[model samples]
Target chain A: MSILSLTAVELGRKIKAKEVSVSEAVEAVLAQIETYDKEYNCYISVDREGARTRARKVQKLIDSGELTGQLAGVPMAVKDNICTKGLLTTCGSKILESFVPTYSAQAVLNLENAGAVIIGKTNMDEFAMGSTTETSAFGVTKNPWNTQHVPGGSSGGSCAAVAADECFFALGSDTGGSIRQPASFCGVTGLKPTYGTVSRYGLVAYASSLDQIGPVAKDVTDCAAVLEAIASYDPKDSTSIKRDDYDFALALTEDVKGLRIGIPKDYFTDGLDQNVRAAVQSAARLLEENGAFVEEFDLSLVQYAIPAYYVIASAEAGSNLARFDGVKYAYRSKDSKGLHEMYKKTRSEGFGEEVRRRIMLGSFVLSSGYYDAYYLKALRTRKLIKNEFDKAFEKYDVILAPAAPTTAPRLGESLIDPVKMYLSDIYTVAVNLAGLPAMSVPCGVDLKGLPIGVQLIADCFKEKNIIRAGYSIEQAVSREKCEAARAAESKATEARN
Target chain B: MADIITDEMIDYVSILAKLELTPAEKEQAKNDMAKMLDYVDMLNELDTSGTEPMYHVFPVSNVFREDVVVNGDDSEGMLKNAPERKDNFYKVPRTVD
Candidate 1:
């Protein structure tokens, strides 16, 4: 068997049984990158020598019967926003393009302790602000399945690399659907663990309240294993919760007979593409067939979630990014006669258009005159949205909805109309607003043949249910299903050619 | 809904946050402030009577633990990245002097 094409769990077993040497595994993955990276652009930087060195060391340990932990020598990619001590973490923004962190993020630190080898940092939306990866300061990440269409953002590069078999799994931070949206676009499994379930110590803060790191992988089991490695409280992150719940991987089961899945009626609104709606309904029926009861539930409050999220995220982003002045670190303006011109010129030149727009919007809302009206009221409505989900969860084990309103739109399709593009994150943003755990698993494909993902949300700290149902309902039993879902992606590429 | 975060208010906020904004930033911020306030008017119509405002949505609160040092003061590499420094302290322009 070509173990190179296997999921992370299978590869772990092979490495444990001595069927695959760590060097062989690492060499094979590295060779694949050497062969296909130029075509996929899934990787922003390749740590070829570093990864090989780590792999050899792990192989020596395994040969000496000293192999320990669940993920020893598992090669993985990480989104750029999550800091790597020695690597450049641009977070897809030019303001910090030259900034390299001195401290690794808690999640990355945990993965390293478990013997995971970091290969490179992936690309993303500028400060994770866009629905598509087109906004990246680094070149846009193309979907591996079809290079013409974008891989989703802000975790698009991570998802693309996984889908293209560049790594066993990748870590992605989700705030306003950055991880899962890209996973769906790439036809991969991405989980956004419960907020604060994973440490935020190394994350370049986009919106502190909403940012949480999670995993994207080829299957649900791999997702669970990666999550287990990284999910823990860090002394560095005061918001992280120290929980006894260390057995997330052990809880993945097919026994979802008593599971109650909620289907939100509002998610199937007029603008939702017919194919996406059908795929979700079909997946729900499959769950019902597996002895899981499916009930339609109300999510009227989710309608307000996107608007509320924009205000809150923009407000927080405005504050967080304000630290990027010319004095502290990063790019500074030249020929400045005064300190004021220095900061203004630097920010104006360093930040992208979208980042500037958000920063301004954020500053506006947080300004003294408007705080009571915008930021305060958005928080109040944010409470209402969370309350509505809390009420729905009381009746259901999981809430299922389309991850986005449609399949990946053409790269430039929504560039002219920012609102229409923002609406694409309409379904996924509420999970962030509510601070709940959610995931995107491949459901099916649209008529155009781009992958369509359906999301499942659960209450905080109840992330097990989200993955359990996701694993149960995953329809990609064959690689052909993945290829079919990615058909539109390649066709777009051919059209461009 | 005037974008009325004045130059003095902007300076005060920057000081509070330990950020330094420039003069052009102050003028741009003033205009941006007004636009944002104009947009905030959209929320004024929503009836939120008796609705208890939520600061966080998580069910668990009071999650902070007592401060306990876990590791060493590893500043060898941290100081390398600092733009300006003298002795062990970050060097800055003098205000008092």
Candidate 2:
């Protein structure tokens, strides 16, 4: 098999066995990027020289038995929002287009310490404010499954890179479905660990409370392995959880027997495409056939999730984004007359339309007369949404839902109506609000040949449940496909006879 | 929801956000914000009587630690990306005469 086709763990094993050198692996992915990236725009930057230099050093460490992790010497991409020292870490916005951090994010540091080679930064939504990567200042990342369709955002580039084999796996931040939706669109596996499971030290603050960095990979096993490499406790981020166990790979059992999976009835209502519904239902049935007790349950407050998420996320974004001015390490306006003018002109010139809209919304919600009516009410609504999820978890070990209402939309369709783009996040946003662990695993392809993802959600810090269930779902889905393909072949032979 | 988002409101909020919008941009912002506000107003449908606002998803607060500095002053490294810099400082527009 081509070295480019190997999963990260497979490549790592080959590198360890000396069958595949780290340099060869890095070279293979870089060559793939050179071939495919122009068409897909999967990456904002590709670090060819740096990755080659790191591969040489990492190969030596592997040879000396100093680095022995499963991800060691594996080439991986990082979402642009995550800081990587000296590598241009634009958060898919002109504001920080030239900005490179002096230090790496805690997640990046953890991955590097595990011996993963940095491929480069992937594209994302500007300040991670939009649902489609079309908002990127660099360029939109197209779905590898179908170029006309969008790879969902703001981790669109990360998911697209994995789907196109531009990298073995990638790290993506999830704030209101940024990672999961894109993963679903691009037909990849993405995990949003329980809030605080992964430290967000250097992840550019979109909505600090909702953001968690996780993995986008080719399969559940790679996602688990990547998550294991990055999930950690850090003193730098106060929200970082000190977990008792970080061994996510141990949860990769293809057994869902007796696992209680809830199908939120509210999620299956109107606006869901029929193909997506059928595919997701098939996933549920597959899990059920594996001895999982799947049942429809009322996950109330579904409609409130979008509104509450926007209000709270935008409020936090407004505050978090206030740091960008003319003086610091971001783009500054040259036409400003004075200090106030500079700040105003710089932000107006630097930010995109969607980002500017969110900041304004945030400021309006937090304004004095409206704070109690809007901001406070939204927070209270958030508590109610979290309460509903908490109540659901009391019965179900894992909740099953469609990762998105439909398959990837054609480019420029969702962006024209911002609210429509926001509504596409209905199924995934509540998980972020409740700080639960969720994943999007590609279950089946749609009529248009776009992939449909089934989201598996577990209670906070119960990543093992989702991981275990996700693995079983992957196994069952793939087995069903094989059986169907064989049946088709036999039928064709019989017809000829 | 009432149509409360006006041109004046957009201008005021943009100023608060430290953004200067063009006339066309302001009109677009006004329209977009009005739509978003109308949609988010659906939250008022749920009666959240006496429910405390969930500021943090996890119950973490006041995460105090040792006062010792972990990262020493790397002024040169920090200043490396500054848009305009003077000797050992990030230079900005003059605020005072």
Candidate 3:
């Protein structure tokens, strides 16, 4: 197998043991990108020459007997919204088409410090606003599994890159399921850490309170390893939670005996596709077989999660995005009557339709007369949802649900229907609302062969619980695939005899 | 409950958001905004009379740091991304004019 096919953890071990040079591994990934990224469109910018230089430096350190961090020499990709000094960090928006940051995001720095060579910046929804990457000004990123379908958005490029094996791992920012949903669509493992666990210092703000940086990788183990490398408290981020050491990779054990898992009834109702429902149901049963005590429960407040999420997210996005007013570092309008005209023209011309709609909605909700009715009401509803999760966690160690209502939609299916696009985030948004940790693990594939994922959510800072359960499900699914393959082989031999 | 978004409301919000929407875009915005507001109006069913709104997830108050400069000014690096700059300052259209 090509070195690119090895998981980040496996590649790290090989690099440490001198089995593979860092430059060789980086070359394998760059070769994969050259081979497949034209069709997948998973990257916005591939740092071909820069990554090769970084890999050589890492190889030198290893040669000198210097101890590097875990993930040494692993090739990685970061979502475009996260700043990488001297690299283009457009949030898939035309406004920042030429904007390059002078500094890297705290998470990107953490990954680099741990010896991960960043191969490229991945594509995302414009301003991380849409559920599908179709809204990206660059172009839509197609799902690797089915090019006719979308790789779920905002973090679509990051997830698709991992799915396509373009990179060993990728960093993705989640706000209302951006990370987990795309991970589901692309059949990769993604984790949206508990709010404040990961620093947001250099991540482009979308919905400040809801946005979080996390990992997208080939499997649960790789996800855990990347999370350990990036999750840290940085003083630069006011919301970053100060912490002691957290070893996420050490938390991955496939033992779930007597673990309490809650299945929220709300997640399985009305809009869920039958195949997704069956896959998630079987995932829950698989957990039960592993000695996890699973039961159904009511989280009625989840019904309000979508409405509240849109209101809060758009409101913050409106405020956060106000900085791009044809001033300082963004696109400036050439034809402008005055300063006011320049501001208006620049924004209208630069922002896409969905971004404009969100800014308008955000302005309306926070408008003087409507503040109490929309913004404030959503905040209260958010509190209620958090309380419900708090109550549920008292009884259950983790919650299991579908990552998305359906598999990846056709490339442009959700784009035309704005409300329909928002509904795609129904199953995963509540975790962000409640400020909890959640992950999407590949459970099975739908009838169309598109992948399905089941979400495992845990209370604040309890990522270990979900990682453990996700590891169990991952193991069970792999075992079943082995058995089925062996059965097919034996049947073929018998028929030939 | 009726179509709350109107041409006047769209114009008002466009100005507030500093966006110059064309007449065609304004019409589309009116319709899209009306639909989205109607959907978000689902929150009105719940009575949150006594509930306190949560602005931030963690209960943090006035985070204080040491009175020292951790990162020095990077004026040169900051100017690298400026679309139009003169020396160390950003150049904008004449405001007083």
User: What is the TM-score of chain A, computed separately for every candidate?
Assistant: 0.94, 0.98, 0.99
Candidate DockQ values, in order, are 0.29, 0.88, 0.81
Candidate 1's residue-wise lDDT over A1-497, tens digit each?
77569888788778878788777777778887888778777776778888888888887776677767667867889898998988877788777777778789999999888878888888888888887777888787788777778887888889988988888899998999998888888999999988888999989899998999999999888999999999997767767877768688765776579999999998888988898899888878767877888999778765677768888998899889877776656666667566565666667777776677677767656777667777888889888888788899899989999888887777666666555677788889989988898989888877777898889899988888987788778743334467866897899899999
DockQ of 2: 0.88
- Candidate 2 structure quality by residue, lDDT tens digits, A1-497: 89988888898899889999999999899989989999999899988999999999999999999999999999999999999989999999999989989999999999999999999999999988887799999999999989999999889999999999999999999999999999999999999999998999999999998999999999999999999888988888999999999888898998889899999999999889999999999999988988999999999889999999999999999999999986887699996778999999889889998998899999999998899999999999999999998899999999999999989999999888999899999999999999999999999998889999999999998999999999998998888889999999999999999
Candidate 2 chain B worst ten-residue window by lDDT: B1-10
TM-score on alpha carbons, each prediction: 0.88, 0.98, 0.99
- Model 1 CA deviation exceeding 4 Å by range: A475-497, B1-45, B59-76, B82-97
Per-residue alpha-carbon lDDT of model 3 for A1-497, expressed as tens digits?
77877999999999999999999998898999999999999999999999999999988887787746669999999999999999999999999998889889999998888889999999999999988898899999999999999999889999999999999999999999999999999999999999999999999999999999999999999999989889998888899997666887767888899999999997888889999999999999999999999999998877789999999999999999999988777688896878888888889999999999999999999998899999999999999999999999999999999999999999778988899899999988988988899999999999999999999999999999999999999999999999999999999999999
TM-score between model 1 and native: 0.88
Using lDDT as the measure, name the better of candidate 1 and candidate 2.
2
- Alpha carbon lDDT at A10, candidate 3: 95
Which ten contiguous residues of candidate 3 chain A have the minimum total lDDT? A61-70
